[model samples]
Target: MAKQVCMGAMMQCSMGMAPSSLVPTPKTVMTSGVMAANIMDNIPIMNIPPFGMCQSPSNPVVAAATAAALGVLTPMPCVPATPAPWAPGAATVLVCGMPALNDSSKLTCIWGGSISINFAGQVTHDIP
Candidate 1:
């Protein structure tokens, strides 16, 4: 059995500008045999969050290259959006599950990785 791993972060919006929109995009880079069962299990309910939006591209070549490197079955594209008002309170996001070799197998080695959110324009968040 694979032990469940959960990671969470509280991101406070301080864009310094009123009425700004934000689209949270989650990116994951993992070793082969790992699958993402639910990307929204721990994520907060925001106006809009781009989940699995790194597969499509304006150029087919770029998309193909990205797909091959990421080992994704289907490519999902990230769409651009205008910034909206910054809601009060901290925005919470979480990623769950450890990389598993298979349904009945789990990797013993510690997997090293990180998650990041790409925002438009100048913006800062209190995340560590």
Candidate 2:
């Protein structure tokens, strides 16, 4: 990954290097209603191209076992959206942080969580 220093925020990765080819090439940006159109056109199976997640494992075997266990076990606290006293159905809502950028030319990064409660008027669970 190649990074560029722009107006201070360590902007994002400018161009990604191919493992097979060590070419430092320029990336093209398209304004045709798609964010990663140019990058996706050249790469196959590149849904949401040029973006990926890198998981750093503190302990590989432990992490894998924990994930496998979580897949089979049920969640301890399942909080559905509880409705107000007057409302009939439960109303689920999420609160999200502001996006990093509003322009089409820039990337937007947002983070947030969901609000969950039980009908028994207890704030049971939250994960963000």
Cα lDDT listed for each candidate: 0.28, 0.20
- Writing each residue's lDDT as its tens digit, candidate 1 over 1-128 gives 22222122212222111122322233362222222222332232342333223333433543576678795544444322323222121223223332211112111101111122222222235678
User: Model 1, residue 68: what's the lDDT?
Assistant: 80
| Candidate 2 Cα outliers beyond 4 Å, as residue runs | 1-45, 50-53, 56-62, 65-128
Q: Please, what is the TM-score per model?
A: 0.16, 0.14
Candidate 2 residue-wise lDDT, 8-120, digit = tens = 11112122111111111123321222221111112212211221221212224334644778743222211111121111111221112111111122221111111111111
Worst 10 residues of 1 by lDDT: 105-114
Count clashes in each candidate, considering only residues at least 3 apart in sequence or on different chains.
5, 0
